[model samples]
Target chain A: MALIRKKIVVKNKQGLHARPAALFVQVANKFDSRITVSNDKEEVNGKSIMGILMLGAEKGTLIVIEADGEDAHSAISELEKIISAEEEK
Target chain B: MIELKGIAAASGISIGPAYKIGKEELVIEREPIKEQDIPIQIQLFEESLIKTRREIIELQKRIGLEMGQEEAEIFDAHLLVLEDRMLIEEVISRLKKEKVNVAYIFSGVLKKYIDVFSKIEDEYLKERIADINDVGKRILRHLLGKEKKSLGDLKEKVIVVAHDLSPSDTAAMHKQLVSAFVTDIGGKTSHTAIMAKSLEIPAVVGVEEATVKIKPSDLLIVDGNKGIVIIDPDEKTLQIYGQEEERLKGIAQRFLSVKDAPAATIDGRTIDIYANIEFPDEVPSVKLHGAMGIGLYRTEFFYMNRKDLPLEEEHYQAYKYVAEEMKPYSVIIRTLDLGGDKFLSQFEIPSEMQPFLGWRAIRFCLARPDIFKLQLRAILRASVHGNLKLMYPMISGIEELEQANRILEEAKEELRNKGIPFNNDIPVGAMIEVPSAAMTADILAKQADFFSIGTNDLIQYSLAVDRVNEKVAYLYEPAHPAVLRLIKNIIDAAHNAHIKVGMCGEMAGEPSFALMLLGLGLDEFSMPPQVIPELKYIIRCVTFKQAQEIAHQALMLSTGREVEEFSHAKLNEVLK
Candidate 1:
């Protein structure tokens, strides 16, 4: 198994808040990859809406997304689309 | 002629037999049980849980179809908390270890959760504690084999007297069969008060000991406009009220005859009569009352009673639903006016000595642009569905108005970039409620497209009287000279700026204030839908000239008492 890692700045205005966090978890759960998102200090499961919200990733915050599985590449790219996309989902 | 004074929750007169609804006081007694019966007790708890789950699911579906899907999702969260493994495990462990009854053990565990959740700083988590308590109560009811009492199927039309009514109870009631409502608790803005106004029933709330004093089947007369309730009246009092009721019924009939007529004065002055609503479900009533449009569609209810903030899609759907329903007619949706007296469980609002004067309405929204922008974006998106306009509540100055407009522009830009459809030319307005806002109407009128006077807050703020406080409630005078001058100033300022002004507060619905407002140059009158017909009848009967003369005289009065007396006398004389 190969591990993929990506660091991205939260671009959406609301950060990883309610609606945005819900969308992030929905996209993260679509792939078979085991995904984890972390700010500098703590790591949380990317597929859990509650976990993602607890990360408190506001706009301009730096966070890292890591995935390990057969579909790690797709999961990372899709998750990044939601996080970096300027328009809210 | 015993008269009990309370808050005038809703307008109109209702005389009927009292129908007392006793509160459901479910007593849970702690009892020791045999250790060997632990398995049976656990089985009983499981069965009750399953039953409660089924009931919640049914309620969710019904509420979704009746209200909106967003509202229905609250039940989904309730279900999740109901099925929480930690809660269930704790209850079972306590039951087994303590060797107590399942009902007692379950309540103990539920209390612990509620206590801890209530202390949390997060408003959302604190709100979720209510869901847990609701679920716990349901399980206890089932465990005790008590049937839930509902007001859905009443056989007679009577005046309902109770301590207080929950939102769900009001929703489940057969509104048509209720002639009036008298409660032991609640103030002007309470759920019961709002519901009574929307349902078009006479109500007097905050009548302490109403449920206890009024026996079932006791003859009662409820004067909602005066906030008076008479129980078991004598012959003379009954005769007087009987004649009054008959006269009111005759007036209502005459009003209905001209329901579809345009609200134009005999002198050819036209006035737009609109309706104020809190729920999307009230749109039908707005139209039924022959309203020209919705002047104030409150958006606060969407933010209430839940753990999570409403998503943009939810706001869009609710706004779109109201706009689409009132096609060709304007729907002025106000932004979230939370905080102060109307606190959201989802936010941690520090307790204030005077909440009404604290951080509230537009102030709260401005502080949290992220939440405010989400709502603005939703309203803009729904603007394309119909004639949708948006307004900001509790805007006290030009700076707040400018800042709100700037954020609105940003929301519009966001939508434009995403290629989402919206009415770019939607009119923006500000509510002239605070005394400062009324005083600065000229400055605000320059930046805002329109103004709607919210007299409820205006009166309270000007008089420095809390409408909810019984001791000082009498000082919350709507006919005060200061309030009248402020209203006149706002209307004059808006007109001078070439913008239309309207009133959508309780003052707009008061019969005595109708002619005064019309004469004061109010372009529109938006009130509870039920009062539209009668107010329209008043408009049609009087000439604009007569109203202007009466208003002029009232403005010269020295005291609120004089103003009230003059208006009352003039109303009777002119209507006759």
Candidate 2:
């Protein structure tokens, strides 16, 4: 199993707010990897809505998204797109 | 016919088929399961999760069809919460070790998540706590086998029976579909009771086992005035209540007939008749009931029923709406009286032994000037909209009053520095709720622009009786000699200082108490909007001189019961 971690800056105006967090959880569930996201200080399960919401990442907040499994690379790339997007998809 | 005794929460009578709402099952009963039942408990947990997922998916589809896709998207988060492996695994693992019912185990796990999310200061995360709680409740409900019906989905008019209704639950009710309601718990001052009064519907509360005793389509007769509910009544009993209901309807019409007239005595003494509102939305009803203005606009609702602190703009808009609506008339806004029986998770107020006597009301505001001045600034900004007044609750002496004013001055200076225009001379009042405040009313009134007696707290403090405690509720009499003396002292002091004194308490809305209060020379009377018409009718029928005579006789009575009976007789005589 491959473990991958990437420190990505949240560029969305609202950061990883409700819509972004929900979208992230949906994408995270598709992978066999165990995903965790942290705002440097406090980390939460990237796949758990409650945990992802607990990070409360605002715009310009730096978060580290970690995925550990065979599909870890694809999970990080997919989530990175949503978090770095300027507007909510 | 089975008769259930309850507290008469609202007046009048109604007969209808009972429509019971399955209890949402927030409180779970922990049944210790045998070791052999572990597999069964595990199966129950899995089944409930599946049921909750199906329910959410079905609801989402329906909402998508009805309210559109955007609104339906909120449920996407709920579905993920149900699928959260960490949460589900924790519950299943805990159940096997603890060997308890799955419903109880699920509630404990749910509470843990809610508590964790609630502690975080982030606003976005705070709102998700509600979603977590909502999904958790649905799962718990299924585990306990409750197929609940939403209050909004009533097809026919029926008497609503429940364990209790929250403010939001009552808000969801359609007035026409809900002819009346009877709850298993809650007292006279509960929000359910208050909503029933405002809805102009009959209700009986505090009926033990009301939900269990009355079944759906059981044919219930709710006698709200007498605090009685007859389940499946006989022909003779039904006929009696049917006529009694009509007689009450006629009386209600008479009360409504006096709606437009000012509440003035026969001898030309006009008192300011006002309504006490909890929400800004109650403004239209205030006018419909012929209230001169809003006397007490309890601002705690801005804090309650929500996560995170309210922005200054939100407070300003609410105050501005009420101020403009009641333009040329006064709207007294009592600032955040947060922590007495109100669970304020936002403040994280340290749990106290005696919350009422402990750090509460003005004390909480004084300690947190950041929160206090935020509200004060909003009130000041809104004051320019129309006639608006602000009052400080639980001010015991001149020191607290002076301290509050000092903060008020800082708020004013901030506005001045920002060059924001507000009414510079907004009437600042003191609420005489504490015993010390009542005693020192003369001193406080010297600086206060007005005085509003909050008899609910005043009586509780003076008599040393917890109003919520049933055992001491008998001791919590408004007509108690000590309470009357304090009120008399307060009114006398306010008048002595040339400031108008009003009463915005349970005592203010009551007919006999209103009669006694008028004689006591109270300049204003404020109560719930629904009570305004009857009070106005009573005021118009009697001369001020006669009320003074009744008050004089009541003052002479030694016991509270005697004073109550004497004043009640005087009120009946005036109405006759």
Candidates 1 onward: DockQ, in order: 0.03, 0.11
Question: Mind giving the per-residue lDDT tens digits that candidate 2 earns over B69-158?
Answer: 444556777788999877888888999899899998889988877887677665556556656776787787788888655688888999
Worst 10 residues of 2 chain B by lDDT: B63-72
- Fnat of each candidate: 0.00, 0.26
Interface RMSD of each: 10.9, 12.8
- Scored against the true structure, residue B170 in model 1 reaches a CA lDDT of 62
Every model's TM-score: 0.62, 0.62
Taking all chains together, the TM-score of candidate 2 against the true structure is: 0.62
Q: Enumerate residue pairs that collide in model 2.
A: none
lDDT (CA) for every model shown? 0.83, 0.85
Per-residue error at B341 for model 1, in Å? 4.6
Chain B TM-score of candidate number 2: 0.68
Best by lDDT: 2
**The candidate that achieves the highest DockQ relative to the unseen native structure:** 2
Candidate 1 lDDT, tens digit per residue, B96-214? Answer: 89999999988887787667545645434433454566677789999888988888868889898988865556667776789999999777766577668766678999999988788
